[model samples]
Target: MIVGGQLVDEPSATSPGTFVSVDNGVPLSATNPAGSGDWTGWSITRSLIDGLPALFARNAATGALY
Candidate 1:
């Protein structure tokens, strides 16, 4: 996930989820629960498959893109 413009590792139940400070929208420390917490820090800024340019052709019988 993303936090304050940087990527962060997944969070656990005990460890607070990725979150940002509402005051300035900065990534708050996992230890700090006073700030916005348990927030999903994901953004679709670009296409992940853009680098892998390819065309998948499915079999005539199969309707799946392969």
Candidate 2:
């Protein structure tokens, strides 16, 4: 897999990534399903990781927050 534009050498290893967004006070509603919520589009500017293999965080000190 690829992370940070570099190839991950460990076949049994894992990588983590995140998605972020900012609230603009705009409401996004689903009419058919009757859903309502504000749309906070993904904040790419604040994303630390992007376009990487699927993973999750578990600890802060170790950079994992699962």
Best candidate, lDDT = 1
For residue 3, model 2's alpha carbon misses the true position, in angstroms, by 0.4
What would the TM-scores of all predictions be? 0.21, 0.16
Candidate 2 — which pairs collide?
20-43, 21-43, 57-65, 57-66, 58-64, 58-65, 58-66, 59-64, 59-65
TM-score result, candidate 1: 0.21
True lDDT of residue 41, candidate 1: 36
Per-residue lDDT tens digits of candidate 1, residues 2-47? Answer: 4553434443444475444344344433421223333233232333
lDDT of each residue in 1-66, candidate 2, tens digit only: 223322223322143552222222222331211122211221112233576554432222233232
Poorest 10 consecutive residues by lDDT, candidate 1: 31-40
Against the unseen true structure, what C-alpha lDDT does each candidate score? 0.37, 0.26
Quote the lDDT for 48 in model 1.
37
